[model samples]
Target: MKNYQLKRLSDQPILQTSDVKPSIDGFDVLGAFNPGACIVNNEVILLLRVAEAPGARPGFVKVPLLEEQNGVPTLIIKEFPEPEEDFDPRVVTIEGKAYLTSLSHLRLARSKDGIHFTVDEKPFLFPARMDESYGIEDARITFLDGKYWITYTAVSEHGPGVGLAVTTDFLDVERIGMILPPPNKDVALFPEKINGKYVLFHRPMVSDIGRPSIWLAESIDGEHWGNNRYLFGGRGANNPRFAWEGGKIGGGPEPMLTDEGWLLCYHGADETHAYSLALALLDKTDPTSILDRSDLPLLSPELPWEREGFFPNVVFSNGWVRWPEGSDKAGQIWVYYGAADDGVGLAELVQS
Candidate 1:
């Protein structure tokens, strides 16, 4: 078996310490940033997971906003009061109940270079309705048929599901509603339609029936998805310590098509929640057929920054850029991932 190793591309964090607020007034914390990557127009865009704490009151939760307070730049937090236990810290509760500890919203940032980024003043995406009252996280972008398709996680008291959104430009997005609901997420759309239908990679969590594993689905119109099947599951064989990736494996970035097969870069997490990057190959025509997979991780939590934070021992990627054909690094892949849930990290794949 050929050993696959992830070469660190950037030592410094790419997207770190976001300043976010809810509405015009709210208390803001250094929000967690992840799942950011390069897009069209040579602009590097980021989908930031903004976290805000409530106000100092019994039932009031604070939402943070960026503004000038008495002549200096300050974060303004808005307070909202609800019944006791309305905002649960552990799980999501809705309609006179508690919900996820922190409300997550998707904020945008743009950059000329993949490193330094400028956050947009407004949030690019939010939980407008009940199904997504819990918030959205982990956005994967794919440009297909002239439009960009974004697949993200929709959280609510019910459970975690997959949501879809489409946009030609980042300015405005069309919400396609929840495509895959309840107990599913980590969706990545194939670059192009297969056999006149769209193909997507997803992971469905089943604690009793099965473990959290990657799956595949097909759709005619990007909105409606069906025909689901399992792609892969937990690590085994001569693979790395099973405990390191025992919980689940998820699709990451867009799969790279090569003469060998579809090269998929994915992340696996263990019981401890430590994450590492691994690779797999799928049939070009039928992605469900596994051709080869790196038993061990291509990248893991080795860097100091990637080994500690909100969640320690994690390196998660959602986006990457592939060089055009004919170049020296034609098939080289650049991945942008989160480090220990604290900040962003970068890595590059040199195709052999």
Candidate 2:
């Protein structure tokens, strides 16, 4: 049965690489996608992952690096010999260390009707500290404790980890530092503490040894996390038997609280390596307990836009908003997701 109505589809990308200029430096914004969704002042707020790559040079491939010199913002251009290293447009691997083909920063975008978005021309956050030298990507926003909390993937030479930041107005951001260590991504927190403890979902990966699986954890004060429980992922050496999601899976946007249970929309890749959206129901009282899961994906790459660009056949979302009760569009969910890892798209799911 069809559940989602790609009803208000944006023919082109709502947010794309060409939408915004490069960060303070001369780096070009290669991709502006994977926005974490939230509603503030009756407007849709998206924390967008903005990836910037260096300008083209014939023999040298450049990677933008953010640094600080005497309290002044600086951009360090890291150049590599084009032929010596494996140079992909998205990744430059050198001496076994895989570095991003571009540096990423988070920018803000806003919308009133939840369809048309107005992205901020200027960058809101950039990589400067050593821990985030590689920059940040894929933020999951949660409103808790009187403020909006952001859990994003922090990349660096050390590895990819999860970091926390809080902002009440989306203007002044207070970073709480890394919450989950390296080899981890896809982190999101429930809006409220369950049974007096904060709950978080994360996908942790081990290099060449462990499988990438979603893990559930609890925190007392939202700072330190513990009591981890494996959630779900592909099994049996990359073929878990689940065809549409046999390759791998990761937690999507913040789970929505419903009368029936906690509704989770996650992304999974099958043997064909196509990324699609899957749904599941988790126990409200004990979120770790799975109640129901869809046998097949609810949304897959169907449109030409969804099947083309940075990562073809991919539809990934980190943000969403429930329609306001007073609005005419109540009882619906607006999912803002990245299409093919290059631009943003939206879909609305009517509640059952």
Candidate 3:
């Protein structure tokens, strides 16, 4: 089998921390990455995951938390004693618990050429529900049933849950609440129904017995998900040859229907927590049947920007757009990835 490779589009990141402004006055933009890509009205739309944190005070370490007040989510700040040494900017570890240094929200950006984008000043989707007290992140959009359905990770003290939302014109959005609750994320809906049922791919993190891996589920109404089947697990440290995914693996963008099968681009991390992208092909009818998979990464952190940032050595994605016919790059895949959890980068998936 020929190896799949991704052609990195630009030398610099497409969207960076500095390019995005914070939602709150005192907060600073930490990262703007992991966008969900789709085409609407002949334009490429990106729902960007924007991570922001407040400015550090003299002696106290402040963290932003969203709390529901009278059924409405409100942003609040909590202070903790500053750590003397080994201060990590991404997270604050106190006692045995951990708190994220920044809160993430989804913002919208549009590009006519799929390269340069005009970002929105405000957030498209933020922490509103109680389950999203920590943040809403890593959205995957699927245009099914005449509406744009979005599945994102809603995080809180409860853990990461899958939340659903729907939009018609991207102007007004309606929340469908949490579907798959806690210890689960990286959910992406299939663009079309299979065998008269809606299908989706999700990742459920395991703590005690098993490792975090990909799973497949089906739904009748697209809201209540069931009939789950274990799809596959990451090739962790046990596999010396494919140790790039030694940590965990999760679903990425919506599956693309191909002549060969259902092509899925997913993310995996090594023992060192270095994330990379890989491809898998599942049976078109029965998605549970895996046809083939990449033994090596299609995209890895090789460049300086991808190797060094808020979280180093990561090239994770939840979104990609197939260049439409009649366009300059028809039938090709344009992947939008998060570079080291700090900035957004673009790549062309040159299938081999």
Candidate 4:
């Protein structure tokens, strides 16, 4: 029923959660979904992923820490009670320590017509240092050789790693820290520079040392990575055949090379975390191989803002915006997802 050409763009929420004052102190700014899209001079750029809280609920847990005190930037808040209701509910352990109900950073959006985005009042990238002190999340922007090379998702308290930053004019940015550490993340790279080296795609869950899937690394010098393999995972854990892609599968946005080879727009989830949107096709010069995919979904989560907010049906993405740039046999891609994580959805694949 949908082979791609699903356009929703924006009914609301291009970016939210910003009263400016964030150094802690009451908090309140709770959404702004994942982004990391790009285009640069032609416009359409989004690095968005802003989440803040104070009254963040849903089984409880809110921890945000980032300090500088007298030098300025500061944010600290940690609260966890009620024995730590596990069994999902977005995790909130207590004595053993665990957090994350909200608090993220990196905000900046602009669009010429990638679908009307224009966010930028504050937050260029927050949570500075101490391993990102519990904030900073899912970015994945890679332009390579010329400049633009983000790769976010830092989160502190010693978990969820994979951070690196660089910008030519996203207004001076250059963090570049943990390449792929604690639990890894959907780190992405590979815009150019493949056959010679530097090609990444991370997702390392390390539950006991396995099952979280999606790997493939190689770097001549894009920040000291190693040579990990894997690729895409999910056939167990939750992909009971494809219970909507079974619960875990990542590596979305930032892959697109095209000529019918490196498209790769992924993001699946099932087992109730319900997020969808798929597309795969690699092997430009051996992008770890893989040929074609999208056995069913090219997008899902049926409207209603992708089925209600704060993570309902989900539909996450890291970025998109393709056009007359090397012609993938067609033109106009535009993607940019993140609906039901609450806001940010724009479709348009169009490849004839």
Which candidate comes out best when scored by TM-score? 3
Candidate 3 clashes between residue pairs 3 or more apart in a chain or in different chains:
none
Quality of model 2 by C-alpha lDDT: 0.82
> What is the Cα-based TM-score of model 3?
0.96
Local distance difference test scores for all models = 0.73, 0.82, 0.91, 0.75
Predictions ranked by lDDT, top down?
3, 2, 4, 1
Prediction RMSDs, each to the true structure: 6.1, 2.3, 1.4, 19.3
lDDT of 1 by residue, 1-352 (tens): 1545678877777667553445325444445556645466666677776654554576555443333456553433444564465434434334555455556677787766566778766678876656676677888888899988888888766788988888888889999889998988888898878778999999887875777788888988888889988888886423556656777778887776777878888888877778888889888888889988876778888878888776678898888877556545555667888787667777887654
| Candidate 3 local lDDT, 144-245, one digit each (tens) | 999999999999988899999999999899999999999899999999999999999999988879988899999999999999999999876587887888
Assess candidate 4 and give its TM-score to the true structure.
Answer: 0.32
Q: Which pairs of residues clash in candidate 2, taking residues 3 or more apart in a chain or in different chains?
A: 37-319
In terms of lDDT, model 4 sits at 0.75
Q: Residues 1-352, candidate 4, lDDT per residue (tens digit)?
A: 2344445555554554442334345676666777888887677788878777776666546666675678765777666654533344445666777777567888887867566667776888887777777788879788889898898879777788888989898998988788888878888898888779988888877665555668888988899988888877765464455777766788876787866678777787877878887777888998778876765667788867678877788878878867655544236777777778656777777653
Off by over 4 Å in 1: 1-4, 18-24, 55-98, 236-241, 324-331
Task: Please estimate how well model 3 matches the true structure, expressed as its whole-model Cα lDDT.
Answer: 0.91
Provide TM-scores for the models: 0.84, 0.93, 0.96, 0.32
Candidate 2: which stretches are off by over 4 Å? 1-8, 67-74, 84-86, 235-241
User: Native-vs-model 1 lDDT?
Assistant: 0.73
Report lDDT (Cα) of residue 81, candidate 1.
Answer: 60
Best candidate according to lDDT? 3
